[model samples]
Every structure is written in structure tokens, then in C-alpha cells.
Target chain A: MVSAAGGGRVLADQDVCVGAGQCARVAPGVFDQADDGLVVLLVRDVPAGEVDAVLDAVDRCPSGAVRLGAPAGGPY
Target chain B: MTTTDPGAATAQPGPQDDVPDFPVPRSCPFSPPQTYAGVRERDALTRVRVHGGKHAWLVARFEDVRTALAHPGASSDARNPAFPALGAGEQQVAAELRPFIRMDPPDHTQVRRMLVGEFTLRRVQALRPEIEAVCAEQVEHLLSRPQPADLVADYANRVSTTVICRLLGVPMEDLEFFRRVTSVSGSRTATAQEVGAALQELFGLLDRLIDLKAVTPGDDLVSRLVNGPLARGEITRTSLLSQIGITLNAGHETSRNAIPLAALDLLRHPDQLDLLRADPSLWPDAVDELLRHLSVADVITLRVATQDIALSVGTIPAGDAFIALLAGANHDPAVFDEPERLDVRRAQRHHVAFGHGVHQCVGQNLGRVELEIALRTLLERVPSLRLAVPESELPMRGASAIFGLDEVPVTW
Candidate 1:
């Protein structure tokens, strides 16, 4: 399988979430950490404009899990 | 940890007492610190004293400078206790917070590749129309303001900030906040407390903005980062935040200075300015020439010798510090005929102003785009713009590693 460094990193909130959504705070529209802590992707492919934000997400991932790939997950 | 001079490392030794200081104040603001001319002449591995009396080899010749930056044995890791600082003292910069420029290999490579893709030739070309719009907007804004405004603030800073903010996906509403934080964080005289406070404000702001993006990601760089790989757990939140912190500043700082400095050079050399205006096609080359001539970056980041590295100057022993004085290297007559003169036609494409090697400025294409647009727009809109104050009276950024005017007042 070809390696995909990172596609657009998004937030997926589970029922365990407490609703303190910070991901939505840093990146609105593309991600939404809803009240009650439901995180969801606003879009699938990274918008042409939001590439910088995606890169920022990689740097900001507190969990140290954010990947650095393009949207659509093409070969890096 | 111990004091050594670049001269001491050289086979030809100057008197120990005569060890020249690094980061010496420039006698003329247009050039590197005055001492570099002499250092460049020696061209051999020479030791120079830095803050805390530590020594670093100064590389000046163009070819040699490029070699040093590209060498694997020379490391950019600031975490190394002996890593040289351009500031007066080395302070503890947390590891996770260190910018990608200060990182070495695998880590630097990984982070840089991610960021580099954002500034590819195609990406920058795509950004041209937006960059031009910023330039036009700033010029119109300047025209509407009273005569004799501060171009550095009104035009240069505004255009650069706008381009960088847009390129990095910073919200337009927060431009003022971004501007204030960047200025404060980069201030040479800012106290630790002041810097920390400003940093705290920025961090808080980013966290809130990031959370917003988490829920409703937009078409911005930050949003892309946050929504993409961030969801996949390929990188870390701390890393993303750290990169944003650095990008917020790096994105604007160079062009902020370069646009005005290049303008000043042109204004002083009216013939060159006239040549550019007369032949509009030359604007792109003029920008490149200005980057080469002004070489506004005082020095490349300090590198530590990971192993004994030999060069034209001499051998840099393992653990020794090294820096390439780009200001001097850009002037090496070997590289350009009449390097001191601002020849808009100069075709030299390899200037190290944006630096070289793996650690070159990631936003350079963006910077160039801003510079080209800002310069052309300012000239076209304010054809008669001239310095409102005496050049000698203008305060240049002092003793700081970078070279820039604090302000450039202009009248048209």
C-alpha cells in the first residue's frame, strides 16, 4: 500500500466526550467540537485555503497524533 | 561552554587579545556589522566571540556559506547546550516549542516537508492574485491617509502582514492581534515577563480558534492542519501549536523588513528605481537583486559542529559553533560583479538571503511574492514617495540578529 503521510486531520467526537470541544475552537468550519463534545468534520477534502490550518493542526495536536498529508490522502 | 574564537580555530592565528566580537553593531545600517569586511577577507576558519564569550566560526564566502549550511555535520538543534544564540544570552527554549528551523534531521525533515508542500511553486503562483490584491489594498489605504505617513507601518508592514495572515489562514478579524503579538515576541528588548505574557495571549487565542476549527473547519491553513492529519493521529497538538506560533511570526518578519529596505535602496539609487519603473518586466529580477544586495538577514542560524568539519577556512572541531554571515557572503565579489551596487539586472539566482540547505526559510516564496507585489504597488501608486526624515536619523533595529528599520516615514 502506498503511504499517505496525512490527509486533512479532523475531529471525531465519541459519546465519551464531555463537550469541552477545543478542536472546533482552533479550526472552525472544517471541524466542529459541538456542545456535549461531539466533534465532526465540516468537509472531507481539505479546502485549497485551509492547507495552512491543516499544517497548524499537525503542530497543535496535543495527542501528538496528527498526521501531515494532503487532503484525499494521495502519496506524500 | 568554553570561550574560543573563530580565529583560534584557524591555522593562522590572530593575537588572542585581538579576538573580535560577533554580532558587532554595523557601522552602516546597509551592510553587515562593520567587522565582517575584515573577517571576510581572512576567509579562513576564524573564531569569533559570541554571547557568554563562546566561539563560533564565521563563514563569509558564497560557496563556503552554502556548503556549511548543507553539511550534515553542522547541526541546527538549539537544544544542544552549546548552541549559539544571536541574542545577548541563551535562554531555555523548551524543546517541544522550538520551531522547525531549529530542529535537525528526521524531525525537521518531517515537519518541513509538510510545511513546504504548502509553499510549493504552484501554491505560491496560485497565491499571486491574492498577494497582489493585498498590495493594492495597502497602497489605496496609504493614499487615503494623510501625507507623510510611516510607510513601514502603513504599507510595508500592512502588506506583509496581510499576505502572511491570509497565506497561513489567520482570520482577517484577528490581524491586529497577530500584528501586536508578532512585534512583541520579536522585540529585542522585551523582558522575559513581557514575552511570556504576550505568548500566553497568543496561545489562548490559538486554542480558542483551534477549538472553533475542530467543529466547523474552514478553508484555511490551520483548518486544513487541524481537520486533516490531526484527525488521523499522525502528528501532535503541541507540534501543531508550536508550528503555528513560529509561522505566525516567520510568515511576516522578513518581508516586513525587506519591502522597506529594498525600497530605501531603490529611493537612494533613483537611477535604479527609474530603471525598474521604465522597464516593468524587471520588477521580478529587481526583487531578486534586492534580496541579494540587501541581504537583510544579518546571520544564518547558529549551527553546532556535530563532527569535525573541514572547509576552506580550516577545520571546525566537533562541538564548536558556526554561523554564516549572509550579509558578507552576499557581497563576496567572487559571486557578483560590483556586488555592492544595486543592479536590478543581476541574474544571480542563488543568494542565501532566504538561506540554504534543509533549514532555508519555508515561507520564502510567499515572502518573494509579497515583496514583488508590495514594491510594485507602492511605486506605482506613490510615484513621488520620498523619505520624510533624514536617513541617518532613522533608528535601525539594533544589536538584534536581523536588520530592519524601526520605521520608514515617507511622503508622496
Candidate 2:
């Protein structure tokens, strides 16, 4: 289910995260890493200004862990 | 999904004579192999002959290379008969030791998890002070040397070796020994026997260090692995040694090659160097730009397909070997504007120089920090640094696994 926040939904799956920290490095405003180096999402909804950076994080992430969720009311 | 036996597939057909040889040597140290420009221009997957006269699929476009790497069907397992080992001993080394970089999931994941915490962003950030100190010490050594000093040997190698040694908790008493080991193990021309001997000597020392760390652990990578993974039975003693060896080698080799090559790039383009000097904040971006430009570890990222994988350019059939040319992807004009130009403020940090996918360089954060500090210190301290000899006369390691200059003669 989408968070339905003010901005687009941002998803980070810790289970598959390889802890490469590309997300945290590429989009620090939206993502961080735990002490164990797993991805920890700081924001559920991506701010408009940070969308490009968040997209870059998705592209740069070695593991398919960080991604943008489908728009609200879109297919699950 | 049907899995074709790689051995059977290889036995069926030989590569066409038209297939170009893999690892076309770079005409200039600052650029990738001149061949990559033509390959990338095709915007498609191509076949190239590798070790043992075998053909492997080569992905050169930026997006296609990333796709090949990110695909789960791509396997790093060296045991696969179709796996490409650029050097004679490389396959044997990977098969015998089973380093996680040459492993697939579950196994790769298990070993990688135990080490990621050590190289996290925050953890590496904390090492900035120590790295700065190492660079400062090396710069002083450079100053003490006579004019026309060898920057590669005097400063770059020393700083990299010292930093990695401290991180691994290895004593600096055997720096020369470690250098000899990497020189042989990393050489593409080294015979299987020579590489085996070099690795044996290295493992012998690491074996002793692991034994010591088991009983007397410290706040270092070896100690942590000793206490955490080995004690937990997640990894065997032999595998642990292999992991540490790769980390130690990786921790230094890329940076050792990068530092001197990057300095030369700056020396070649004084305007870019001036841009960095004026706004010191641009140092980090400059380091990345240099890494992208130099692409020293161009041919190191080797892979083979486990299942048929489709790319925008073409489909890589299962049981076939493949390689993602990092140098090609980094220089793709479609991805980078004026790819040949070295712009410090390029704002492009997505280069695959550290590689892409799960097996990307684990020590990348540390590598980034180390390079940033080393180059910045060199430029900041030695403002008048310039090439002591014509760039044409500089010796390059043309056929080695890692690309770099044998010596960068410079004076201030």
C-alpha cells in the first residue's frame, strides 16, 4: 500500500539491500544506513525538489533494494 | 528456466576468427582502450576473444553494461567452465579460495554482510582525520626526496600501503614484502607458478595474523572478522584469509594506480587543477571525475550469464561468458557530456568505475576518501608540482590487470 503522503511514494526494502550505501550517498535527504549498514528510509514520501536525487539513488543502488513505488491508486 | 551446461556449450563451437581480442590496451593512460570508442558507438553487445581463445559477450554501452551487471542471471561463480579469467592463474585462485566477489548469492550475501558495517559511510567518514595524516606524512616524504622524484613510488604507493595496513592491522615492517606480492599477483604476464607462489607467501603471513587476532582481537577489520565471522562458523579459516587478502589488495591497488594517474591528469590540464585550487570544495567531485576518466580497473569486472539475459542492444544466451567494460560505460558520450573532457564540476557521480551491482567494489567509500585526501594534499602542499619529464617517455603497465604508470616523475 502506498503511504499516500504529499509527494511520491519512496520504498526501500531492507531484506534485499546489500548495504552498498548508494542510496544514502546519492539521496541523503531521503535515505540513510543503520549501524549494520542496511538501508533505512528517512522519508516515506519524496519531496518534489529531492525527486531527481532519489531517482539517481534508485539508478545508482547496486542492489535492487531502493526504488520508487507506484503512484497512489496505481497497480500494486 | 533451462540451464545449459557451459562445458557442453563450449565444446560445440569455437569463436569466429573475426572476434577481436579482449582487453585492447589503452593507447593513453588517461583514456580507455582506443577500441572502446568504436564498440560503444555501435550501441550494442559484441563478442571478444578472452583467455584460452574463448569468446565472451562484451557490453559497452552505459545502460546495457549496467543492465548486464544488475541482472540476477549474471553469475560471478568462477567454477563455471565459461567464466572468463583474463590471466592464467586468476581462475585457479578464485576456484581455490572462493572470495565472495567471485561468488553468487546466499554465499556472497553471508560473507558480505559481516564486512559491510566496517566500510559504511559513517565509518569511513570517521577515518578522514587518519587519512589526512597519512597524506601529510607522504607529502613530507615527497618533499625530502631529490628533484625529479618518482611520485608513484614515493608518495602514492606509500600512502595507500600505510592506510590499508593500518585498517587491516598489519604491521608496516613487511611493506616491501606486500609490494612484491601484489606486483606478481596483479601482473597479467606472470606465470601461474609465479602468481601461486606470491599468493602462498601472502596467505602464510595472513594465516599467522589471523591466528594472533583470534586470541588478541583489536579494533581493526581482521580482528572483527576473526571474532565475528570465523568464531560464528559462517566462514572457514581459508576463506577468511582469502577475503582479507582481496580486501587488502583492493583497498590499495586501485588507489595506488589512481593517485599518480590523477595527478598526471591534473598536470596535463592546469586549468582544471586551477579550478580545484580556487574552490577547494570541488576536490571530492574532482576525485570522482578522475576515477571515471582514468578507469584504472577497467578489465577487472568479469562475469558470465547463468540464464539468457536481454539488453537494449542484444540478448546474452545462457552459459555464455560476459564482461561489463567499466571504461566504456564511464566514457559513453550519451551518458556523459563531452566524455573525453575532464571537468571537475561535471556533477556526474554515477560512473561505474567502482563497478555496478552487488559485487561492486566493497571498499569504494574508503577508496573515494583516500583518493580525495591524497590528491588534494599533493596539490595543496606542492603548488608548483609539474612533470619532470615529457609525458611521452613515462612508462605504462600496458598488459597488467590494473592500469597505471610505473613511475610518475615530477618536481616542484
Candidate 3:
């Protein structure tokens, strides 16, 4: 779901994830856990309203697996 | 077994024989208190012996324990044959999944360097406002909930888990499962079968995620680690798993124990609680004091002596193992005056709760930020927060290595 706040892409790197379950804690609507418990992104494009929260989650990731793209959508 | 050769130096005297004591059990379980009461009574640096099967040195003195921790011969390798004891077969399985915290020097240094930037004060500070907000939201949630709420399970545990999950880039929906897995891992009672099952399940999950990252690299730490410096034959798959395991293991439990203990201590001492309430600026110092006083991880960091070493208290011969008792050291009179008293204003920068030197908890700064926010927000939002049951009724001490209450029943 690309947010109108200027749709931007959010990439979640699965390799470095130790499954600490943080992104889900911060933005439950956007991040979901698979049956195996690893994180799965619910949405690729983040709305403007949720950008700040998503960015916050990105910054907090210990494994640095989360990245946010520009509204126009390019490589994070 | 056999005493040191007569020509060799005499080992340090252990606990005075006159002191009452109990045998160190065959298994190192976390529940029921381990026999550290005698050790606690001695000076922070007292040399004591614990009889499990053989005599094991117990470093209770603050200074001596610190010295032992930094000593060149203190080995972090679990592979050491002389290593005293571990909880279950899970230790072996867990060993295969070893994290950097369990490794010594060179490897530990390199792995930690990669993570050092992510946990820096600058990064942690950036999350301060968010941490405060999370604390406020949790407090509000608690206030709205039914009374006699278990603070450890509900608030403290949740807060730490949430923060750590965010740091690890895990998805939101998976937080509950991840928390459950980590909780089980933290328990000493967990069977090896349970541990293996959990590990297999976790690894399977990680495998898929790793595959995804390999194909579509993101800007997250995982992607960076996969493609960046670690890609050049420096880091391996097994090594990556180890780091992840360590990060998750340390991320929540330590903070979970510390937060409620600090709360309980402050609540028990209304004077300190009142002072903290009156001056929010004292929150940072208050946290340091609580860490020093509670020292929730009471189990000493394990170390095996590689060579005979002498100290003011006694001598520890090569091959003997010892534990640096943080709780005992924190209360050592030699280090802190009125060691048992909780003084929010006390100068406690030298405390070893996060440890010292190379193995010091890498997440200490992040832990402090989380703690300060939790304490301040809890006090501010739930001014009437107090234990719902008598202190005696509460499960204040952990049955495992990480000490804290099983349930902190509280009412707003």
C-alpha cells in the first residue's frame, strides 16, 4: 500500500534478521511474521503518514535490515 | 580432584568453613536460588569455593571479579573441557548457534566491531523520544487494563521486546512468537528437545529470510551485512547466526529484569520514589543506581583460569573455573558504602552490571536509554503505581540466570 504522503518503497533484508520482532512491534500494520516467525513485509510502499514510524523502525533495527525509499521509489 | 603440585603455589582459601552453605547442585538450573548467600556476605572480592562435583573458585569481591573478567587467561570459550556446568543438552545445541558474546577477543572483537555502530550512543539517543513514547503508551495500556497485572510479562517484557525487535528489523506481526521463542530460550527448565525444536524452527525461518535478502537486498543491517564488509569472506553463515542469537538473547531479558526490579526497589523505598518523582532529571542516575543495587543477572560471568594467579584474597590455580558475582560485587562495602541501601543520588559510574572491558555488554547504552525512558514514563504516568500483592507473594527472583520477578503484580 503506497501512502499518499508520497508513495515510497520499504525494503526488509531477511538475511540479517535474528527475528527480534521489532518492526512488527513498531508498525504492526506493515510488518507480519511468517509461520516460522521471521518477519514478512505487509506492504512494499509506505504511505506518507506512516513514513515517520517506518523510518523509526528502520533506524532501530540492530541488524540494519530495513531501508526506506524516496517517494518516487528508487533503490534505498 | 588433585591439589596443585606442592611446588606450585597454594590456591586461595575458599569460603570460611564456619559459614553455613549448601552444595552446588549437579545441574545449573536458574530457578531455586544457587548457593551464593555465603559469597554475598563476604567482601566483594572474597575468594570462595563452590562444591558442585569439584571445588570451583567463586570470586565475590568487586575488584577481584573485575580483575578476573579482564584477566588474559579468563577464557570465554565454552569448549574448555574444565568448564564447570551448563543447564541442559540445549547448551551444546546452543553452542552450535553461539553468538559473539560467548567468544573471546579476536573473533569477539571483529564481530562486535561490525555491530558497534548500530548500538552507538548517537543511534540510541536518536531513539530516545520514541522510547519515551513507547513507555508512555505502555503505561497507558497498563492503566486501562485490569488490576493485579504482571508487570514483567505485560509491561517490562513487552517494552524490551518491542525495542529489540525494532532494532533487529523483525516484522510487527511476529513479535509475539519471537518473544515466546526467546522467553523459552531464557528458561533454564527448557529441555534440550524443546531447545532443539525451537532452534530448528528459528533456523528454518532465518533460512528463508536469508534467501530473500540474497535475492533482494534492502538497506537494512541484514542486507548491509550480507553485501557489505562481511561479504568478503570475513563473516560466515554460522557466524551470522551466532551474532543474531546473541543480539536476541541479550536484547530483552536483561532489560526486562532490570526495569521491574528498579520499580519494585523504588516503590519499596517511597523516599527514593518520591525524590525521583520530584526531579525527573534524576532518572539517569536513578537507573545507574538501580542497576548497581539490583544487579539482576546475579550469576557471575563464568571464567576459567588459564594460569595460576594470586590476589589479595587468595590464589586461583590454572584450569580452575570461577564466576564473577555481579550482585555480590555491587553490594561490596569496599566499592559502595551502605552496599545494600538504594541511593538514587549515589555516584555509581564504576558499577559492573553491564560488565567491563572487551566483554562489557555492547547494548549497555541502548539499555540505559530504554531503562531511563521506562522509569521516567512509568513514574510520570502511573503516579499511583504500587504492588498489588505483598512483596513476599511476588516472584521477585528469577529461577534462571537472569534474575527478576516472574510476575510483578501492580495496580495503577
DockQ of 1: 0.02
**Model 2, range B1-412, lDDT digits (tens) per residue?**
1122333333123533466777787788888888888777763466777777767877888888888898999999998888888887778778877888899998998888988888899999999999999999999999999998999889999999999989888877855566678888888777778888998998988999999998998989999989988998989998998899888887777788899999889989999998988899888889889999999988887888888878766678888888899999999998999999999999777899988888988788899999999998998999899999988888998767788888988999
Worst 10 residues of 1 chain A by lDDT: A13-22
| Model 3 per-residue lDDT tens digits across residues B1-412 | 2223323433343443432221233121112234454554543223334323323466667777677776767776666655543345434554566667666767776787677556655567778987887788777777777888878777887788778766765444554565567656656567767777776666666656666777788645566566655568788887786676667667777888788878878888899988877887888788888888777665637667787655545667788776777766777777788877888999544577876445667677788889988877887777888888876676644335476677788987
* Model 3 lDDT per residue over A21-75, tens place: 4566566767754433345899877855787678656644544556776554354
Q: What's candidate 3's DockQ score?
A: 0.02
Off by over 4 Å in 1: A1-76, B1-18, B88-91, B94-96, B174-176, B191-193
Candidate no. 1 TM-score: 0.79
Candidate 1's residue-wise lDDT over B94-139, tens digit each? 3436777788877776666556557644567688998888889888
- Worst 10-residue lDDT window for candidate 2 chain B reads B1-10
Write model 1 residue lDDT over A33-60, tens digit each, in one string.
Answer: 4322234568765665666555554333
- The best-first sequence of candidates by lDDT reads 2, 1, 3
For all the predictions, what are the DockQ values? 0.02, 0.71, 0.02
**True lDDT of residue B105, candidate 3:** 64
A best-first ranking of the candidates according to their TM-score comes to 2, 1, 3
**All candidates in order of DockQ, best leading:** 2, 1, 3
Whichever of 2 and 3 has more lDDT, that candidate is: 2
CA shift at A1, candidate 3, in angstroms?
63
